[model samples]
Target: MSKPLEQNFVELLEQHQNIVHKVCRLYTNNYDAHNDLFQEITIQLWKAFPKFRGDSKFSTWMYRVGLNTAITLYRKSKRTINTQQFDTVQFKISAEEYDSTEEDQLKLLYNAVHQLNDIEKALVFLYLEDKNYKEISETMGITEVNARVKMNRVKTKLRTILNP
Candidate 1:
């Protein structure tokens, strides 16, 4: 890439870097993994930047590419499957009985979301970010109706996971 193009890319990335960070957070649990995934996403973006035309907003395009990269990596990587055994019978602290703060609920929600597959995580992330179905569909290259249906399914799955 030309210096001007490189500089422009840097500026745009710097401006919208939080998008990448959010993607990293959704995909990774630890700080090192988060940084590595962010770097990989940045590298992928840099490699594809030369082919970018202004057909869509840069941010929207970034989401598509970032999500695709994450989904691909997630499919290929061999993460350690949890090996510890857990007791089936546990103490009961019901939501109504326990005075949980908003942050506590947020943490629980994030933990549940972390258990989702990459594609489901992308959908949930986009939905949580308040993106409309049209935007989600465009970002994921799915039909708007499909996006809505998938999101509904994801919501139901989240409810089950969080509740169970």
Candidate 2:
């Protein structure tokens, strides 16, 4: 990469690194794995960045590449590892305002999400990020209708996991 392109990539990546982090969190089991996957995604993004025409927003393009990397290159055998505990302050919630019940529920939700297949997890991640069906379809290279159908099935699967 040229100096100017390198600088541009660094600036844009810094601005939208959270998308990579979110994808990393959804796909990996432990902190080490998360870091590894994040690194891999960043590397993949850097390699693919030169091909990125200004057809979509940088963040949107980042999502497509990030998801593809996670699904295709970074997937590993599922492991039943305990989820990492996070401080409430990290999430910007006051310690005093924290509810253990809600926290437990959140953990359960993540646990369920962690159990989903790679493709299902990608769907859930996009859905949680408020990406519409069209964007999800575009990101996953599925038809819009298939994205909607898969999302509904993912939702149903999550509900079953939570309620059963």
> Judged by lDDT, which candidate is best?
2
Highest TM-score model number: 2
Which digits, one per residue and each the tens of the lDDT, describe model 2 over residues 21-86?
999888766678788989999999999989999887788789989988888764454444445654
TM-score of model 1 relative to the true fold? 0.85
Worst 10 residues of 2 by lDDT: 84-93
Quote each prediction's TM-score.
0.85, 0.87
Model 2 compared with the native: what TM-score?
0.87
lDDT tens digits by residue: candidate 1, 1-164: 58999999999999988889888777766667778989999999999999999788898989998889877887788573221112221223454654557547866777788777778889999888888999999999999999999999999999999898
